[model samples]
Target: MRPPVRLALAAAAASALQIPLQPPNGANVQPVLVESDALADRVGAGNLQKRAEALYEIAELSVDEYGHPTRVIGSRGHLGTINYIKSTLDGLGGYYNLSDQIFSAVSGSVYQAKLVIGDVVPSFTTMGLTPATENKEPVHGDLVLVGDLGCKSSDYPDTAMGSILLIRRGECSFGQKSELAGQAGAVAAVVVNSEQDEIHGTLGAPSPNHVATFGLSGATGGGFIEKLESGEVLDAIAYMDADVDIIETMNIVAQTTHGDPDNCVMLGGHSDSVTEGPGINDDGSGSLSVLEVAVQLSHYKVNNCVRFGWWSGEEEGLLGSNYYVASLSEEENAKLRLFMDYDMMASPNFAYQVYDATDAANPVGSEKLRDLYTAWYEDHGLNYSLIPFDGRSDYDGFIRHGIPAGGIATGAEGVKTEAEEDMFGGRAGEWYDPCYHQLCDDLHNVNLTAWEVNTKASTFALSPFALSTTRSTANAGWV
Candidate 1:
């Protein structure tokens, strides 16, 4: 947390009597639905027609061809992206509320990696180069092989300590296996795809500093397993470098204001991506699209406030956004009337999915937002349905705080269907976003129609919820 955070938190709590925390299960809440056409005019062909420049800016970030700013911990890309996000937020031309959330500890770097085998596959899976041992000297041992060596104690299966572990992937995260292998006393591990075909996957739980691990093809894993099952001892040369220390990361925040100095609206997106792939659709689409909305909202200030956030270390864990939420006092949290999080808005699979946000009988803000999204889809005659909140985005923070939170995404990891394209008119099988975490996600990959459509939806999502009054957050008494 930063000084401003502590000071603002103190101020938000000053003389404010503590209120009992409302449990989501018990709260008898009502939906504050903003069903209005206030933004319809601005959204139509006319105003949208004139905002080409702004649209272009948003496209540059969200579209796949231009390449997104993806940076990992302990990397130049990470630092560059941090600066880029900050600069973009500053460019929105407002009183920027920025802060840094440093990590609990710095993970050492991975150095000197080697695989002793015939033709080591170039592509592999491992948690992001976690701190590893660069043991240059080759260690000879009996090769113990297994399939999907998960964290379950049963996974050990009489495996020899300090021996190599050759396993295929499935039923667990890559990180789970790495941490589990480390605990199992395996000096090194060789993980291959469960199938011969390589399907990109998450290596492990988000961790900047974890372990030295890698992935392989089934053929490669099979070769090792065969040697092990045949009772043949194995020896391989491996090298790795691990650097442990403090690594710097940050959060990017921009705000637009309107009514009630005590209460405000929130919007957020993550600004980080994994290595190798620039996460244009994963979150770049969400972040920049919302950034553009923040810019437009700032230009035409409303009664309620808008705080646009670009969270860091999101790919590593909900680190940046969680830190911000953690610093908020209950009073400050109460003042948060609404939170709108946009993650992967232009998904490779661009279904108009409504998030499950509302249930009037026991209304939560997110539930309310979900209701709003569903209504919007119905009213617009769009094919969509709300999915459950699956702890896969930045909204996790606000939802946990009992604030009303909701947002949108195109799709990722999931495939697009022919019917979807027939309706939305895109390629089938290819997701709404094909280059989600791959290098292919550039400016060329964006759907122009989706861009315009989402922009219109965002106008509705943000504006009506706030008083449609004029600019000047101070006049509205909002901060």
Candidate 2:
């Protein structure tokens, strides 16, 4: 059960923010049984496009200090995103119960730093909550390579003392790597990306025991590793002038009031974007897609409850979703039968990718959700591929606590292969969404065709789960 005080305060906040709550629409219409095809057919491109444009306009109206529109958590743009979702649902006529889950997320206050290796200054991202350099002076030292991933103490060499450590990112938090480096007597740490893309990470919290750390792209780091392996000596300079601040944010959760509460089908996407851009395709695409589904779903009565969550602070390491799961009671946790996360649903160079729930980390019965999603694309004669069901999105919280979870994504920051090009008909070697985290991820960044297909896929995947008692057998009958 939601706390009465919290709900009251949330309502008060909405009122103070002047968010318009509309009367329920078509309250007298009789709800029909939820059939997969029928629900999926209701997902239209026109409405989806309108929502996309609305989100883009919201971002445009909420500019940051740089005059760039952003929906980062606690910003006017994100607040508008929240209001837009709330008002859309409120117009549905009391078919759903709405609540706000509030929390605080701590992030780096600023970034005024650089990392120079040899004579080259590769593009880099500053790690969150890491310490600033002393007096803003760049520390120059010999770059000592840490063995393996540097997750364990044995990986640090004795030569690391008084030197800058080059650590590969994997199997550990940035904080842990920095802590181990500090213990090894290293002055600073440089973590290389594990993938082809750039690495932007957080230390989870302020770590006073940690030395200053930085992140580098995979290509740049790989070059450094190759040189070091060939017995090349390298000099490095690292500096970070930064601090931390806590931002107040909240998650918007709405559930169908008429369905069985004990068995719920939950769907979510983060509402906040990176501070760099509007993030329409990165997440506004997913967020608005879910919003349109919620609006359409209001006309139906389900056997199982359907909950929708618009999470905040996901760009800061899924803090909003993490806080929500942690705040749930055992009984409340059990009420959630399954969770589906939709992120980056409309990448310009899009490919239909379903979450591979067969990974050992997920709970039992998750594969059924994957099967349901893939079957939808297959039935429609569409091409789809399996992506790792890693804890990179809001679903991370649900999966960690043994909840069965799955979802779809277009793609982000990942290079598309030639085979994927043959499968989805886009140019190979380019990023699935080149705009990704940049300011260019605006309305035009979305591929409308891909967005429509995935939105329909979401409708198909979610309908049966809302009507069945168990996750396993729900989609089997429908597909």
Please tell me which predicted candidate would have the highest TM-score against the true structure.
2
| Candidate 2 ranges beyond 4 A from true positions | 1-29, 128-131, 135-137, 158-162, 185-187, 195-197, 359-361, 470-479
Q: What does the lDDT read for residue 105 in candidate 1?
A: 22
TM-score of each: 0.70, 0.87
Q: List the residue pairs that clash in candidate 2.
A: 24-93
lDDT of 2 at 438: 77
Ten-residue region with minimum lDDT total, candidate 1? 1-10
Tell me the whole-model lDDT of each prediction, alpha carbons only: 0.55, 0.81
Q: What is the lDDT of candidate 2?
A: 0.81
- lDDT for each residue of candidate 2 in 231-280, tens digit (9 for 90 to 100): 99999998887655666678999998877898888999999888668999
Q: Which residues of candidate 1, in runs, are more than 4 Å off?
A: 1-70, 73-122, 136-149, 166-173, 190-210, 216-245, 358-363, 418-432, 468-479
Displacement of residue 52 (Cα, Å) in model 1 is 13
Model 1 has a clash total of 42
